[model samples]
Target: MRDLQLYASEAQRYPPESVRNHMISNSIVPIARQFNEDMDALRGLLPTQTPCPLPARMAFVRNKKSLEGIIQRLDHRKIAATNIIARYNNGFHLLYLLANLSRLDGFRLHCNILSAADGIKALSVSQDALSQTLSRRHDALEAELQGQKAEVVEGLQYQGSKTSLALASLESRVHSQQQSLDELSSRMSSAVASPDVLGRMVRAELRQQLEPLLHRFADVSLLIDQIALGVSKKASEHSDFKTGGSGAIHGLSNPGSERRVIYTWVTTYRVRGSQDGYFRFRFVFMPRSWLCSTGISLVFSSGPDEFGHYSICPSILPIQIIPYSSPVWDIFERDDAFAVRQLVEHGKLGLRALTEFGQNLLRHAVHDNLPNICRYLLRDSGYGTLFLDDADMSMEIPWSLIADRSVEDDIESTREILQLLRAYSDSGDDSGNQSEWGWNNIFCSPCLSFEQKKSYGHLFLEFGATLRLFSWIRNDDMELNKSLLNFYLDTGGDPNQFAKTGIPPLLFALLLLSRGDIEPDISLVTILISAGADIYYIHDPDNDPDTARTTTDWAFALEVEDLWEAALEECGLDIASVYAESDRRLQDHRRLRGATRSGVDVESITEPGPSSELRRRAGQAGRRCEEGWIAE
Candidate 1:
């Protein structure tokens, strides 16, 4: 039973399915049962043999033949014993196989338990690391939320402060405006209380201010009227003197006795004809008053035997010579002549008027056959100084034409007529008190002192023709004057020659431009420039220092330079280049003049002098004349 218990314990150590059930059934189980049965039988037999002795059992196999039979039996018995032992060994081998299988199953179960334990330990470590990472993330999110909340709080505070400031400013402005409105209302109520008193006060103040001004204005007007009347009386006296009437007549009771009266015939040639057909002249003359209508008269004598005198008025001469509808007057009115024929025709009309008047006188002389009258008018009448009283008639007479027709037989009469006509035309009395003859007196008058004559002579020799041409320019004869200027320049007249007025021709032309009397003629300026007139030349300050003083007061140089630059541009010259070129040319010319005068005889040109200082002065005057210093 004990052995069976041990085997059952061993089998329980492993599951039944772990050990092979076939092995147990075929070998281990059967062997275990047979061994148990054999043990029981041996126990019964051993008790029976235990009563017998060991020598007595051996005596049964003693004799040889008997021994052989016995041996065979014994061999058979040995064979049987060996077979039992082999069967036991085979059963033991089955037990050993089942034990090994049980052990293998136990080892596999232990390995599986170790693997499950390792897996559980790794899962716990991973869980610990994940929890730490989640804790760190939670802390970071809390910090970020705190920062955002603080920034929101700061923004709200800033917005609240700005709103407070804006509201305060608006409230203050509203208060100021309300105060202004209240003050304006109070002032308006006060103004509305006394409207009539305010109006009267305003009106009284205005009248009080204006009364003295009105009285002063009336007094000034009365004074001005009295002054105007006196000025008119003086102006009339001056006009009488200018027009060759006797202003001394106002101081004289018998004004007609002061007049110097004479009579002459218009022609001296006698013709074979009847008694009296001649023009008689009468003259009562003042200085330069021969052409005055109040000082002269004309009469026609036409009768066979009786001397009948008919008066002719001098004022009716121009009306008869040029009727209102005449084309000659039209030429004067239009003031523009396109062709030479037009000018010639106009001049012919003037000549025709003088010629016809002379012819009429000649006819009356021939018809009267007045030999005694011709002699009395030419030699005995003493009327040679008398002139025609009409100024317009004298101007239109063409005195040169009349001189050309003078006869040797009537030479004295022709000379007397020409002298009177020239004196009448050239004197200032013909135009007005103001002389229209510019710079002519400097050359024509012979009564000047020697020094004055010398100074004027130089100017006249240098610029006489040009000055006369300028006179034509004043008469609206620009084309003729331009031609005359060109001719004078062609004949070696210096365009830069200064007049006695101490003004250059170009400066005079510029003065005319300033006066708006002439258009800016580029051609005329170019001609002057080409004839050696300096574009950049300024008048010497020593000659006319007043010009500089006036320029400073008026700032005239800027205006002059602007006009000059504009004129140069109109003439198609670049102003800067022209100015530079002109300065260069002037320098060259000055150098040339200085070099040429180095060996000149200074003493030969000066007057005979008593002292060194006078000689020096005369030398300086000669040099100044050579340098063209015209005296004003």
Candidate 2:
């Protein structure tokens, strides 16, 4: 009741618009009904005495019928009507006097009389009439000017000026426009006749030759778009793209230096036409973040007539135009060009309105293009090729596609393993003929490309190690594979060089063991153990741990727990017995070295002796020494 009294006092003192009367209700239905009733009563009392009541009032008045042919119309709502009534009631007498004076002014305007009311009213009436007439004339002039069109010329068109001296303005603006055009023309000419003309020509020829590549590129783009849409939808659902304060993950606008990447045109050209030909421009994306590697290149062709619309040229054709002699055409051919074409031509339905469509396309290309590219290198190219191409792709491609992915690093590591294999194979003269080489010699001679040798050595070692791991597990040649595993460990191959940032060889072996691909070869286990590979490195169940148990045999039978232990205990061949077997072979090596030093009978000592217990141990020790391993 006190609240009601205060509200009533407020409403009487202030216009309805100034006072917001609120009510509390027992229930929703009753409250709504009470509100309607109160609003109706307030609305009905508005026009009587409230029109000009307060300094601030909420009244909707439209000029329905003013002195000039204007009309005042007012909204007949409760608050608005009440406000109008209160304002009018407060100024009723003053308004009446003004109305009388207005009538005298109207009479004076026609009669030219000079009474007190007439003089003031006449001035107001004349000023209003003059202002209205001038405003109407200005509107008409503006409409006429807008309707006028400049005459079309056969050769040139002039830009009109706001001032009366339009011709002078046109001449001045034309000089600036011509200057810009001339500069651009000079650049285009210089680009055409560049010292690197061969490169430019090759790119052009490539565009024509690899017309199919462009199509494939388009197809790849579509696939990327589809994939991007999926990822974006998920990311967006999980995140926001709104622009806000810096580093606020919600908004994606400007993605800033961290998330946003800039793209530059790779090549630009103009195709001559009857009028103005199409301008073809190609953009290559480079992500700012050091983390992003794979970039994508896009071609956009537009015409003067098209204005904002541009024809997107998908992948350019595959051509060998670069300075490098060996072309990558074979690799691109092996990629799913047909599938890419299908994606661009027929797939990805509901993603037309996105401006970041190109970004999505690049993403799809990374997923689709990168794997295939890796496979080609693995099969036909060397590890070195992988490094060069991977670097190029990363540097040149758009990051938006693979911004969230780390698979490229794994691929790079794989390349490193392949390189290591080459090094291992090259270290020997047999050329992978022995059981030690594994069946196909995945890292053998075919990989010794001239270009590959020039590549980074560290990367090569990584590839060699990874490949060695894969081969070891795949062939399950445990006894024979021990040397390879030991080489990787002893050489200090990075233990954390895999996608999981851990040694992959161990995992591959363990996984193979788990799947029963091949029983952990006793010999392999022994070598790994001897080299200090953590056999007891138990893996968390959540994380895959592939480790084996092995102990080193440093010149002593007891120290070697793997192969040597089995031979000594299970085979009943004690250390003394093996030592006897290896004696003759050890003597032969000593004889050969002596003869070679003395420049006599080197060939005669080359023949090894028949197997003996002492000779076996000596031979084993000699082999270890040859491999740079000290037998303690």
Candidate 3:
């Protein structure tokens, strides 16, 4: 409402149609887009069940058709949500949709979604509050200013009366002093009979004539002394220079004297409103005080790092350094759960874009070792998925953050964070959400130090993280040692565990060894065999030695056939029989491949080629493999 008037006042510069268009495009359009985004986030959190069986999910979609209608109305260029767009019906629809999110328990979530809810409510409340503030009858700042001005006027009137009295007294004292001067002049001219009599007579006349004026001078000196004493007391008791957001003017002297500026200030008020409004930006100049030779252009950093400016303002646009309000990031450091929830729940996490802390807020909390806050963000607050922002390792999920060894070692706090992450993993419904599978890919990228890997690797795996650790061969960190692998096994990582790709770690490690990234060690092969890696476990019967070059080929490729045989022998399996069985398996694979191409049901005709009991045990130890992970 205030913006409409503000733009209306710009009539001399912009056309009426252009002004309205600018308001709609600049103010209303952005607000509507944010509202739509908040809606989408709420929809994502909304449960499928109508009754909202779980608030933890964020929000349940109450009506898909209505949601689509709103989306279609709002998508990209076809915006309709505004004050005067469609016979005023558009606003009703928006309000109703917002209401659906509030009051109803289904609209609220314990997580970041609540921020969306609070944000929606704040939107409504802020609109109403702003309207009231802009109304003609409700000019709080102007009214207060007017009231102060009235007191100042009254004080000035009283000051005028006191001035009049002081001037009158000054006139009376001047007349008295003039009368004494006349009497002294008269005494000096008076005649004396004898020489002795003349001297005595003149001195006696001077004393008699000057007594009243001398007493007046004494009284005047006492008054000046008293005034000086009072002024000194007042100066000591009170500060002369005052500063505030409104504005403060300070100088070296009072009015009508030479003034040196202690500080300089200027304010701009709403020149078009019914009552003068105080919506302003204060620009306090510190030109010579703070600016250096190059300070006007370049900024110097004294801190370790700085969060970037998350503004829409372009680099082409000139920006001035002005006083800004306390940032939300600073507020996050307050450690108040209520304040944190207030920020997250009020849609700040979802709706606000420009106000986003230049860093990943969740990462900040984790770095500070605030597990309780982590719990709120990860699970309770509807803060959305951790894995989506994969571009920045520092800003996204704690996969790399947990691997950061530079952070102070507080195992107890770290353990709590692990527990929170585990709970977050379990509560998440990963049935169709493919992004949720990012949780399972913990150990895949071995980017952390060997010590870091040993410290948190086991805990991550044990606390619900699966051992789907598979990084590309070139990116593999070859520095990983035997102790770390042993730690992973001791904690919970079972290479023989249930998985789709039963690519045995034994073969995976041998492939790494063959790449010559790490120094070859027979113990690397021995360690896997000791940890229950099935050298005889073939994931797929079709993984033939000749037809498909698989990890199984790596043993022969690296000339580790001796180590492979020894491992089989140690696992109480016959090397001769295993090789013979592998040969038979290769032949059967070819037969099956040919039969399948000719439209035969290979599964129906598939049979056990060898009757050996040892082969059956190897098959039992490992079976599932499509992408080559072996599991018992």
Candidate 4:
């Protein structure tokens, strides 16, 4: 039984699924059967099927003591039964404990195996994913490095190309420079080799050419000196001839034996719109055989078809003779008186009208054969100097304006005079040698020097007063404004006359802008410009002062003022607010003047006309005059 028990315990310890039922039957069934049999014995009971009478069974169990003993035995049997129950209960408890322990150990082993398998699978998957990720990253990095290397290579190639181009250009330039240097060296060598001989030849030629010119110049000088000396002697002897000429005819030659008239020419033209007429007198030459006397001749033609008849008047005269009296002189005096009166009664408006009238009068004079006469004289006599008797009145006339009839005419006359003088002075030049002379030399050579010339004794006061009037204008002495106006009106002083510095009255007014004491007078500017002072005249930059070097009107105004406010009140821009405003204002002023001359009411026009429009109108007017649509 012990062995069986040990075997059973071992079987329980190593219970395989195949023998589980056998182990349970062998270990527990017998113990359960013994416990059941013991309980039955303690009960001492039989089934009803057993054949026994009830009375017989009662008799056998009679007597209290005997019954008590039987009871005791039954009691023992119950105790034994209780013992067996206790053992069975304890054994069942032990078996249950062992089975639960076995189940718990199996469960632990299964859990450990599952956990390790899962762990291994997870590690393997993670490693594979990690390797794929690393490979992809490495490929991307390698591609990026390769792209970078290609870009670097391309950049290096581009830089190399640029460097090569630059080197080629440098080499080409160096070669060109070397060639230029070689050529320059060759030229320098040749120049140095023959410089002395070339210089000697040039000097010799120049000296040979200059010798004849010098000799001729000396002869001309001597002739001029002799003429001047003879004139001075005559002037000294006949002092009355110099002082007596208030009218044009004051120095008329008295018929005398000492003077003989050579050739004379005269003509008369009736003044348009007046009863007056201009009488012209011309003398060709005077002989020294007439004891230094001069001849005067008067001639007139009855018609253009008739031969002109001439009359000679022998006269003792100075070299400079006063002009003869004529209806033209009388007209000039009347014009002067009218101008003075109008200026006193009115103002600059009157002066402007007078200026226009004077210009008309000059145009008429020039048109009526005065230019022709002057041209003939200049061409016939190779001397530019001519003396008019009425010096005071003649000075008042704008002779320059008359002389500037047309640019072509003036140029032709100037050329002819120059050629004639050159021919006379250098008659021996058969070599056709050409030499140039300045305008000043040709025109001023025969005229007396400014210092050597005598003043108009009777006209000195008037000239001084006129000069004083100019001074007053310069000094802004408005107190004598009326006197100055009167003087200007009477004398018709040239407002556009150039000063020694070549500045005109308009430019002088501009210069006055810098003077703090004098207000910039727009009215003065207007007057000067209306009187024909050229506002747009540009001074030679080389000769002009630094301030006057500014060429435009607006630029000049800007230089005069540092601020706009100051510029507003000064710089002759009273009607202007800004630089552009001043420019428009000046343009308007010029347009207005030009339009008025064309009989247009410029104030009624809103738009300022262009400068070319005015010039066109002037050209049209000139054409009309030439066509005799309007009388000169």
Clash counts per candidate, in order, are 0, 74, 26, 7
* lDDT tens digits, residue span 1-632, model 4: 24334545665677476544433434243543443343344234321222334443333334324434544553454444345434554345435543453355346434533443454455566668989999999999999999999999999999999999997876566444433432111112222244445445534543332333334234423333443343333332323211111111111122233343354545454644888665555444443321332322223333221134433443323331212232333444433434433433564221111111122222333322243333333343222222211111121322223223222233333333334333323223121111111111211223323221112111222222122123323445432333333334234445545554455555555565556776554445444433433334435435323322221363356355333234234334332333344344445445544232336543422232234111111233234323433110
Candidate 3 C-alpha lDDT tens digits along 250-313: 1111121232212222223333345644321212212221121111111222212124333332
**Model 2 stretches with alpha carbons more than 4 Å out:** 1-285, 288-339, 342-558, 561-563, 568-574, 580-598, 601-609, 612-632
Candidate 2: tens digits of C-alpha lDDT, residues 1-632? 23333444554566556633332222323322343454344343333332233211222122112211210111122233334334644534433433453355345433421232344454456668989999999999987766563234312343332343775665455444433432111012222233244434434533433232244234423333343343333332333222111121112122243434444443323443545444445555544322233445554556432245555545432111111122223333356544433433564321111113223322233433445443333333334322322222312222122222332234453343334334322322222213123312322223333223223223433333221222455455554455444445444532222322233343444444443445534444334333323222222223321221111112232323344445334433364544543443334434443232245544432222232121112233334533534211
The local distance difference test score of each candidate is 0.38, 0.35, 0.44, 0.37
TM-score of each: 0.24, 0.21, 0.34, 0.21
Task: After superposing candidate 3 on the true structure, give the runs of residues whose Cα lies further than 4 Å from its correct spot.
Answer: 1-360, 363-369, 372-409, 418-463, 470-480, 497-502, 537-546, 549-552, 562-574, 594-632
Please tell me which predicted candidate would have the highest lDDT against the true structure: 3
Which one wins by TM-score: 1 or 2? 1
Score candidate 2 by TM-score against the native: 0.21
Model 3 lDDT, residue 37, Cα: 63
lDDT value, residue 81 of candidate 4: 35
TM-score of 1: 0.24
Q: What is the lDDT of candidate 3?
A: 0.44
